[model samples]
Target: MRHRLAELRGPGVPAKALDARALAALAANPGCGRRALLDGAGVDKASLAERLGAPAPFGQSQFALTRGNAFEARVKADGGAELLRLAHEALDRGAEPPARARLPDLTATGPEGRAARTALALREATAEAGSWTLLDHPMLALEVAGSPAFLEPDAVVVHPDGRWTVVEIKSFPMLDGAADAAKVGAAARQAAVYVLALERVAAHLAGPPEGPAGAGAPRVRHRVLLVCPKDFSNLPAASAVDVRRQRAVTARQLARLTRVEDIAAALPEGVCFSPELPPEELTAAVEAVPAAYAPECLATCELAFHCRGRSRAAGAVTPLGRPVRAELGGLTTVDDVLAAARGEAGDPDDPVVAALRRAATLREQALREAAEVAACR
Candidate 1:
C-alpha cells in the first residue's frame, strides 16, 4: 500500500505529512473522495492546485506565524509551569497544584519512535497515581483511510487520577473570557483528533475488555484545554472545551472514508497526481476521482478553487452548497433543476419536481406583479 501510494505521489516527490488540522478538516468533509484519496496518498494539494492554475488564496503571513510561535513558546516556558497550572484550573480543579510537575524528555529518533515513547510515558505517568506529568509536543499516531498520520498536540497533561487532557495553544486573543466561536470550534475539532489518538494508546494499554469494564486504565478526558492570549494582552488564558461530540463525529467520519488502495485500484493504469505532470495530464488524473465539492471546502482545502471551477463548468449544483444540493434530490445540474421548474421535464408526481414547478409559478407571478407596478408608475 505504501509503495502504491508513493507511485501515486509521483517519482521522487516527497509526500507531505498530514497534520491534525488537515485531518480535522478532512473528517468534516468525509464525502469528498478526491480529498480522501489525495490526502491518503500524501499528495501535496497546494502544489497540485498551483500547477492547475488555481492557487489557494489564503495562508498565514510570516509575521503571524512568528507571533503565534512566540506566544506558544511563552505559554510553554518555565518547564510548562503556566501550561500545567492552566490545565489544572480548567480540567482538574480538585487535584493538587502542578508545581514541580514532571516534564519528561520525549525526544526520539523519528515519529514512530516518538509515538512509542509517548505511549510508554503515558503508561508510566498513569502508574504514578498522584503526580502530574506534562508531555510537551507529544507525537501520536492515528490511522486515516488505512494510512498512519502522526499528530503532535501542543501538550498532554496527566492528571493526578490518571486522566489525560489534550492542550491546544494558540495566539488568538480571548476577549471577556471568550474567543472567536469559529476559531474555537476549529481548535476544538483539532483537539478532538488528539483525544482520539490518545484513546488508541489508552485502549492498547488497557488491552481487551477482561471483565465487565476495563479497570484502572488511563482515561482520556473529553474536555481539552485551549490556551490563548487574554484580552488584547500577552497574558495567557485557558478554557476547557467539551469535545466528546466532536470526537465521536470525527471517529465516525474517518471510519467512513474510502481506503486509499480501493480508490487507487479503480484509477486508470498510469494515473499520478504529481505536480510535475503536464497540466492537461494532471487535470485528467485528478478528474478520474469523483469529488464532493461544496463551497465550505474553500476555507479548508487547497484544491477547492480548482474543484470549484470544475464544478461550475460542469453545471453541478453542488457549488451552490450542500444544503441546496441535498434539497435538489435527483436533480444534480442547474439545467435539470431549471427544466423541471419550467415544467419542460420531470414527472409531475415527483414531489421535488412539483415543488419546483410551484416555486417557478410563484416567481413568475411576482415578476408580473412587479412589472405591472412599474408600468403604472
Candidate 2:
C-alpha cells in the first residue's frame, strides 16, 4: 500500500506524514475524496497546491510562532508547576491539589518505540497512583485511511484516581471569559483527536474495552483541559472542554473516510504525482480523483484554492457554500441554476426551480431600482 501511494507521488519525492493539525483538518472535511487519498498517501499537499498553480494561504507569522513557543515553554516551566495548578483548578476541584508531579522520561529512537514508551509510562502512572503524573510531549499513533498518523499532545495528566486527562495549551487569548469561537472550535477538534488517541492507549491498559478504568484499567476522560492565555496577559487560564460530541463526530467521520487501500486499488496503473513531471501530467493525475469542493475547505485545506479554481471553472455551485448548493437541489452547477432561472432548463413547476425564478425576479427588481436611483442622482 505504501508503495502504491509512493507510486502515486512519483519516483523520488519523499512522502509527508500527516501531523496532528493535518489529521484534524482531514477529520473536519472527510468527504473530499481527493483530500482523503492525498493525505492517506502522505502526499505533500502544499507542494501539490503550488505545482497546481494555487499556493496555500500564508502560514503563521514569525511573531506568532515565537510567541507560541515562548508561551508553551512558560507553561511547562519549573517542572510544570503552573500547568499542574491550572489542571487542579480545571479538573480536580473536589480533591486536594497535587504539590508534586512526575515527569516521565519517554525518549525513544522512533515513533513505534516512543509509542511503546508512552504506553509504559501510562501504565506506570496508573499503577503508582500516589501523585500526579504528566507525560510531556508523548507520541501517540492513530490509524487514518489505513495509515498510521503520529500525534503529540501538549501534555497528558494522570490523576491520582487512575483516570487520565488530555491537556491542550494554545497561545490564542481567552478574553473576558471566552476565546474566539473559531479558534476555540479548532482547538477543541484538535484536542478531541488527542483524546481519541489516548483512548487507544487506554484500551491496552487491561480493561475489557467497556468497563470503568480502575485497578485493572486506565480511562481517558471525555472532558479535556484547554489552557490559553488569560485576557491580554501571558498567564495561563484553564477550562474544561466537553469533547464528547466532537469525539463521537470525529470518530464517525474518520470511519466514513475512504480507505487508502481502496483508493490505491482504484487508481490507473501508471498514475504519479511527482513534481518532476510536466504540468499537464501532474494536473491530469490530480484531476483523476474526484473532489468535493466547497468554500469552507479554504480554512482547513491547503488544496482549497486549486480545488476552488477547478470548481469555479466547472461552474460547480458548491463553491458558493453548502447551504446555497443544498437549496438548488438537483441543480449542481451555477450554470444549471442560471439556466433554470432563465426558464431554459428544469421544469418551472418544480419547487426548486420556482424558488430560483422568484429569487431571480427579486434580484432583477432590486438591481433595476438601484440603477434608477443612480440615474436620477
Candidate 3:
C-alpha cells in the first residue's frame, strides 16, 4: 500500500521550493521568527507528536542517497519544476532507476574542483582493480532490529578472506595529527550504522542452525573501511576500523538512539525530521567535514552562495565561504585584499591571501593607467 501510494504521487519538487517557502515565512514573521521549516511543511507537527525516542534520529544511507539524487537532478535542470517531473517519472517506474552519474567540470576553474576530480579518478581506479565493488550496485534490503531496512554502501567488497567490507569514499584528504578526530569519528559512526544493519542481515539469512547435517551458514563479518587521500594531489590512503572499534561506536550510537524521543519532544511544535541550522552556522559546520565542499556539496547546498559570499568577503580562500564582513580584523573585501598586497592590511598575516589581493590591485592599477593613456592619446 505504501509502495502504491508512493507510486501514485508525482515526482518530488526540489527541497529549495520548500526552503523558499520557509524563508518566506521567516520573512513574514519577524517577531519570534519561526525557524522550523518542517512545521511549515505540515509533516512535522502531525506525524511525530510526543515520540520520545532513544538516540538522535539519523538518516538511513538509502534515504540520504535518494535525496541526493533528487538534488542532483534539480541542479542539472537549473530549477525545481524539472526536478519534479524527473521525480514523478521515477515514482511511476515503481523503483528509482539508475541514471548516469554527473561529473564535475574541473577545467572551468573558479575554485579547486580538480582536487575532487582527482580523488574520484583514484576511487574509480580502485574500483577497476576490484578493490571494492563500484558504487550504485543493487543491494538487497536487510533486517534491522527485527524490521526490514534497505541500504547501499558507497562501495562494498568481498575480501579474499571471505569477509564483507563496507567502504565509504570521502573526498577529503587526511589531515596531519589528531586534528581530524571529529571528522573521522563522524564518518566512523555512519559506517558503524551500516555495519550493525549488515550484521542483522547476515544473521537473518543464516537461517536455522543445523548440527551434523551439513548446512552452511552465511559468512558475513562486520568490517568497515573508509577511503580518503592521505594528502593533496591524489596520494592514496585509507582508514580501517577493526571489529572492536565498530562495537564501541555501535554501543555509543545505540545509547544515543534511545533518547530519540527526547530530541523529538524538545523540537518546536510543527517541526519534522528535516534538520535545520542557520545558513551561516551550516556553512561553517560542513567545513569541518574537511573537503566536504567537493562538487557534490557545492552543487547541492542551497546555502552555497551564502557560504561563497562569506568566503569571498573574508578575502582568503582557506576557509572558503566565511562571512568576515563588519568584523574586519583580517582581509574582508577586495579593497582589503589590495591593501594586504600593498603591505596595507597591516602585517603579512596571510601571504597567499595578500598575493591574490596584490594581483587584484595590479589589475585595477593597470586598468586605470590604460584609461589615462587612452584619454591622452
Candidate 4:
C-alpha cells in the first residue's frame, strides 16, 4: 500500500507558528466591514477580527487553539513556496522586533525551538545539486529573501541539473475541493515572492551581466513540494498522489502573483486593514449605516446581533434590514439569487408580488401569536 503525504511529513509545528503569527497580525489591525464578504460569499472579516481581538479566557492564542489540531494537517495540505511565502510575507509585513538574537538560534532545545536548525539542515541538502547553490551560506541576516527561501525548508533539494525544490512537511489529511482558488492563489503568490527574493540574493552573489540568474550560469529554477496526508485521520493506506495534486494547484497559483511593487503601490498609505477586504468597497458597505439581518445574513455575520435588532425595528419582510422585499421587486438580496429563489421577480405578468405580500401576512401572524404567548408567560 502506498503511504500518504501526511505520514511522511509528520506534524507541522512550524506551520502552526506561522498561523499564530497571522492571527496576531489580524488582531493588531482589524480591517474593513463584512458587507463585501456577504456580497462575495467569502470568509467573514469582522467575525475573524473579533475572534482574534477577543481575549481568550485561558490566555491562549485563538488561532493556535482553534487551528491547533490541524496545524500539522494544514501544513501537509499547503503546497510549495506559496504557503511558506505567505507566512514569511505576513511576518515581514506585520511586526518589527528588536534584534535580540541576530540569527535564528538553531541549537535551541525542544521541537519548536529547533525549527531554524531543521530548516538549515534541509537547505544544506538542497544545495548539493549542481543547479542549486545555497548562496551566502553559514551567515546570518534579517531576511531569508537574501538566501534560499524556505528560506529555511525542512530541506532544500537542488537537482544535479540546477533546478531547486523546497520541501515542507505536515501531518494532515488531503481534501479535494475544500481548497479555494483565492487561498491557493495566495499560496502561489507567496512562493513566487520567495523565488523573486532568492533570485535577488542569488544574482547578487553571482554578480550581474546576464540577468537575475547571473551571466555565466543558467538561473536556478524553484518549485515547492508540500508533503501531506493521503487520507483522513493519518491513514497510511492513502498514497502520495496528494502531493501531485498540490503541485498542479501551485502551478495555478503562480498565475495570480502580483508584482511586489504593484501590491505595495496598491496599499493605502499608512493603513493596514484586517481581513484584507477591498478598502473602497468596505468603506461603502459598512460605515454608520442602519443595521439589518436575515436568515442568510445571520448564518455568516458576527455583526448579526446589531443587524438583527435593526431589522426587527424596521419591520421589513425577508428580515434583511430596511429594504422591504417589495422594494427589491419581491426578491432576495442580489438579483441572481432573487431570480433563482422567486423565479419571477422581474416578470410583469406573474403574481409574485401578491404572493410575497401574503407570505408577509403569515409571518406577521406568527410573530403576533409568539408575542401573545410571551406576555402570558
TM values, all candidates: 0.97, 0.93, 0.33, 0.31
- The better-scoring model by TM-score among 2 and 3 is 2
Residues 1-377, candidate 3, lDDT per residue (tens digit)?
22221221113411221221222222222221112222222223111211212122323488656654543333234322332223324222242232322222223232124323323432343323312122222233432212233444454443222234555555555655221665565566556655654455445533432322124533333445555545653333455554447445454433322122232334344332322434334333323221212122232333334334445555543343323332334554566555666665556555565555667678889999999999999
Judged by lDDT relative to the true structure, which candidate is superior, 1 or 3? 1
Rank order (by lDDT, best first): 1, 2, 3, 4
Ten residues in sequence with the least summed lDDT for candidate 3: 45-54
Candidate 1 lDDT, 1-377, residue by residue in tens: 89999999999989899999999999999988899999989999999999999999777999999999999999989989999889888887787898788888898998999999999998888777587889999999999998999999999998887778999999899999999999999999999999999999988885432221246543888989999999999999999999999999999999999887888899999999988789999999999998999998999999999999999999999999999998999999999999999999999999999999999999999999999999999
Prediction 1 TM-score vs. true = 0.97
What digit string (tens of lDDT, one per residue) describes model 4 on residues 289-309?
Answer: 223345544433445544554
Please give the CA lDDT of all the candidate structures. Answer: 0.91, 0.86, 0.38, 0.36
In model 3, the runs with Cα more than 4 Å from the true position are 1-149, 175-179, 207-223, 246-377
Best by lDDT: 1
Off by over 4 Å in 2: 208-218, 364-377
Cα deviation in Å at residue 213, candidate 1?
14
Model 3 TM-score relative to the real fold: 0.33
Model 4, residue 331: what's the lDDT?
53
Note the clash tally of each candidate. 0, 0, 21, 12
Measured with C-alpha atoms, the lDDT of residue 213 in candidate 3 is: 18
**Alpha-carbon RMSD to native, per candidate:** 2.2, 2.5, 19.6, 16.3
Comparing candidate 3 with candidate 4, which one achieves the higher lDDT?
3
